[model samples]
Target: MHRSVLPLVRQTLGKHPAMMGVASAATGFMRQMSIKPFTPANRRREFQLKDRVESLHACRTQIFKEKGVGELPTIVVGGFVPDATEQVEFQRPLFREYGSVYYLNYPRHGFSLEMFFAQLADLIEYLNARRQRPVLFGVSFGCGLIAQFLKESANDPNLKIRGVALASPVLCTADLIRPEGEKAGGVRMLESNLKRILKSAAEGSEGVERQIERARRCFQALFETGAANRALTGRHLSIRKKIMHVIETTPADGGYQRVLALQQLDGPRDGEAVFTGPTLALLAEAEDNLLVPTSPTLSLLRDPERRRHLFPRLSFWKVTSPEPDDAVAHASLIFHHHCYNPLIRSWYHKLQAPQLFAVI
Candidate 1:
């Protein structure tokens, strides 16, 4: 019976043109895989990029393998991105010591558990077949995937994972998803507007259609402004907001709420539950768009009891500077330009070195 749902789901997903774009915009969801044109300069650039990282297209996954020492500590880094494009060139040098660096891409315009788990299963199988144990490091939603892996492989002894690390983990409670009263910033305002729009669509839109369009336009403006200001990256945050608000407003009538259901699950609290191996977490300072201060998901990790109990081995480096005016610091919320600054890169390598990657 479950096998019968796949085709209908795909059909429904493809039915709406806007849904396709929404999906793509959500995950940098470009589906076409085009080879760059063969110009000498382009070839040279590709070669240079290839030298830094090897790209592999295999069975619903695009893996970017970085140059590693070949015989050092084995490790693999993966995430929810359709393509780990932004992280491709970042901190390449650090990966050199690892036996390999693999960034697994999500399925086109999607981050589905079945697809993600299958790909991960393949990776783990490939690694298990090898002579060494692989160190797995996941960031953000990647951390959630790691949790799944841990749950699935708890009894399997051959899969040697050195540790797990999550940067600004997503953990949340129920009530926070839908809050009453005034929204604080552009992000919340946009979310509020989008929620209203989706509700109008789900219910029969009579005169409500015009109001919905107006709200949609307002939300679009917020997205554009955020993107222009560099607060949001293209359309990622806006799509995220859309999805969050949709689920939040969805009727509690049981079937499977999926995303929101996951949001309600309990995760190992910060410093509360020590993982099987070494653990590291880069607690972002409030300003990082990757982890907003008000996110209910992050509150799970902030609890003192949870921190003390679960993350005893967890090493945390504030992803921000202690002072707001320190423009050079990585976590300065007001001035996020620091995220890409070279000094911040150094901080990442430094923190990553002592915690996740042992000196080889």
Candidate 2:
């Protein structure tokens, strides 16, 4: 093993500790892994659609089970990092509590948009028939999707979305500009590389294996950039190590945008009216340091007017310790530690807790 590269993986995963463990567990590409896909009584289905404006040619949806007479609360997981292939790990524990779990892969990587949208509609309808409200959990692109759904459902009272949890939620496009914002060098590099890979793949300039090679490099580049950036900036070693590990194990061929659509992926539109649900906003300590926590962004849900106008029920927490060994104060719904480790139980429970209603 490239011991020198371990630092990169540690830093990246350490910064986003909750995701570190699962990401570390992603030892190889999804195709090579023997783990079976989640199956509902209905099994899973895939769909494809074309987006003329975005030039998004495809999308997909995977279901674990079919609808039944038994009513179980559904938990939806959507957020795919190319390095994090085993997304199931994040929800398997939650599924133990919730009746069922459903996972969606965006158009850029696993499934296409048309498939994802169609399957989501079907799942929502199925849940309605059973009188069960599914807990929507989304990270990054999925966060935006959840927000859009909430906004659209504002008029539909029957929409059975009971709760929403946005982990490391991408709230603002500006946030991407830096490791703290959309302009972050790592993100820009990954985006540019993806566009190039997509162009080549679409041209059929190479065989399936070659296309996969391009994808693997893209994922590696993203992870490496993140790790390198942290190292240069003198950030924590855990984040850097995690990033390195991700780059090391991530497959050269597995596509991510196919899993998490990048074009459709936009941070919160600037100046858009704030929207809310039973929302838990997670902020990483390193990220907070990179981007100053101002009133506008920090007050995402604290202001009464904003809370009532957007999400009447909103809570916020800042993750201060990305290392479990660090003697520091921990907050509710905020996790700070190594991702591959089990430091997120409290944070996870806090997000899922029913006690948040009291704050709302």
Candidate 3:
């Protein structure tokens, strides 16, 4: 949180951690229970994905097929803090029209970041073996992992990825977790406050609530839903609640270790400017909160001359809100697929076309 708002949260939620946890738990429970998760059921293709080197870092995957989308499936590595239950929502609009997508639920109990990345590499190879090269779509931290995966496989003559899409990319954990000095501003309260909330997840129940509430508070501040927040309270509550639910349930160590794991990957060496094959960076219009141009990921993606030299095929595009009033947010990458899907669909088609530079 910005140093300015910390005192307010202290005054309102109080000094005691339990009081803080209990306060948000009640409302979170009500809201959480109110919106039931979309069950995969018949649409789901469930299976356990084991790591190559026999590690306990395997993650479960569910492939949902939209009837008649064909056998070519896209691998979607979603960002942190989402209710693992709502796996189906990630498919809407994006795959609804015509596609198959598989979602990975990161090991919730305990796992290391290196292990998980290795596990993701295993999953990609596993899927690639069975079918055609799978397209990759990622949001937030998931995007960071995708970038790492590409860097890891950069030397391979035959990488099987069909295409890649990244939204609200969080390429560095060190920058996000640390407090921002006014002299070196860019870290938003939403991103900084996450360090503390995510840490709470490692503590268990009370920790979980602390994680949920602080995350909610961060979003409230991000969207400016409350008087305390200096930003605009966006008009999209339905979307806001869904984003909150993501924070409430994502895989932590006890579950929280995921944060530390990501920190482990400071991201592809700034010097290793090796850009993968066909890539698309989906950016948000507004910055300073969650994503800023100066941030590592955004900066890398935004530089045209640099990308032209290194990541020649990498293209950049911005997504607008689904609703006129609801602005595009950090979490909206998966949540607001309507705006994103068209661009992605277009990008994929362009990647396969004879001329990659075909206009959208």
Candidate 4:
């Protein structure tokens, strides 16, 4: 009973209104239960702010200072999860030559999309105030946030972005939840199923808790032996352990909420029309089973009409491995240093020479 199957089951049971209501109620209760009270450890490791900045949703900002000569460009990394500090730190060296890297954990790993956007806006303003136009590097779900930010700030004259690099971007949430079929119908089915589940499970608090526990177990099992874990090869055991820790510590309720938020996204089409800066989208060569498949991403970035219309200065790269054993997947893309480091460096060099864009 992998967590991936939950959506499928909800889809299949879409016709049952009673069951959908029950499931929905149970899911909401579980998410509420997942919220943990603030602790000192969270402040120390998770939400370590670099400077005294006004809090957005009580989230403390963390910036990794770079050791280099002269004022280097700043690189702001939007992490996938609140505990994404490790992921951000791992890529610090890659951007060390370019600029300082920074990341902030969400307040208690629970925030609405609007709040998240506000947090990003604050960070962008903080950098801009220092006369720094940062190169945004968004990993996983962070990619969606970055895309939305780009769209929202398109008209802001003060916000000058150097470039944007997305690694395994989760552009659309519906693609991840709904099965391969009619997109509209799939969304309706999911909604119906959720309502039915919530209604049927609208029992006393204890009963709902029991049902939530059952769902949690199913999700845990899915992560243990699911497509998402398939990317964790022996070479990436360390990363795998960190991922498992995140799964174990973070509540599935919050994760699913994030997924729901992503499902509502339409990507940065309108913003892309106005965004003339350099953009880089990195996709895994192999099929991504964890989140949405890479095909849609490739289609979005590779389609000539869409590319020309959306990302005029887009550089799309499909990361591949010569050896089957060394193949990279969605989760492993961030850890694939040998591959991404050079690619990022090349892109940074290109950004440095704006005249090259005119020549091409």
Best by TM-score: 3
RMSD of each: 15.3, 10.1, 10.8, 13.6
lDDT tens digits, residues 244-304, model 4?
5665564434444454456556764532563467888777765344443333554566576
Residue-level lDDT tens digits of model 1 in 250-282: 232211222323443354544434365666665
- Candidate 1 yields a Cα-based lDDT of 0.44
* Candidate number that wins on TM-score, 3 or 4: 3
Please list the residue runs of candidate 3 whose C-alpha ends up more than 4 Å from where it truly belongs after superposition. 1-68, 83-93, 96-98, 156-159, 174-180, 183-187, 195-213, 216-246, 249-255, 268-271, 321-326, 334-336, 352-360
- In candidate 2, how many Å is residue 124 off? 2.2
User: Best lDDT goes to which candidate?
Assistant: 3
Using lDDT as the measure, name the better of candidate 2 and candidate 3. 3
Report the Cα lDDT for residue 126, model 3. 62
Higher-ranked by TM-score: 1 or 2: 2
Give stretches of model 2 more than 4 Å off.
Answer: 1-58, 65-74, 82-85, 88-91, 106-114, 171-215, 221-260, 265-276, 288-309, 322-360
Error of 2 at 100 (Å): 2.2
Per-residue lDDT for 221 in model 2?
57
Decreasing TM-score order of the candidates: 3, 4, 2, 1
Model 1: lDDT of residue 290:
33
What is the per-residue lDDT of model 3 for residues 1-360, given as tens digits with 9 covering 90 to 100?
598986576566555656565655564464344333222322211224243334453343323333325444566677664532232353444443434556555655554555555445655566566655666777777777777767766766444777777777777775365534433554567565566666665686687656755665565454344223322111123334555555555543324555655776656344456465677788775534565434666565567665555456777887777567666666564445567767777876665564334334
- Against the true structure, candidate 4 has what lDDT? 0.54
TM-score of each: 0.52, 0.54, 0.65, 0.64
Segments in model 4 whose C-alpha atoms lie over 4 Å from true places: 1-82, 179-242, 268-274, 288-296, 353-360
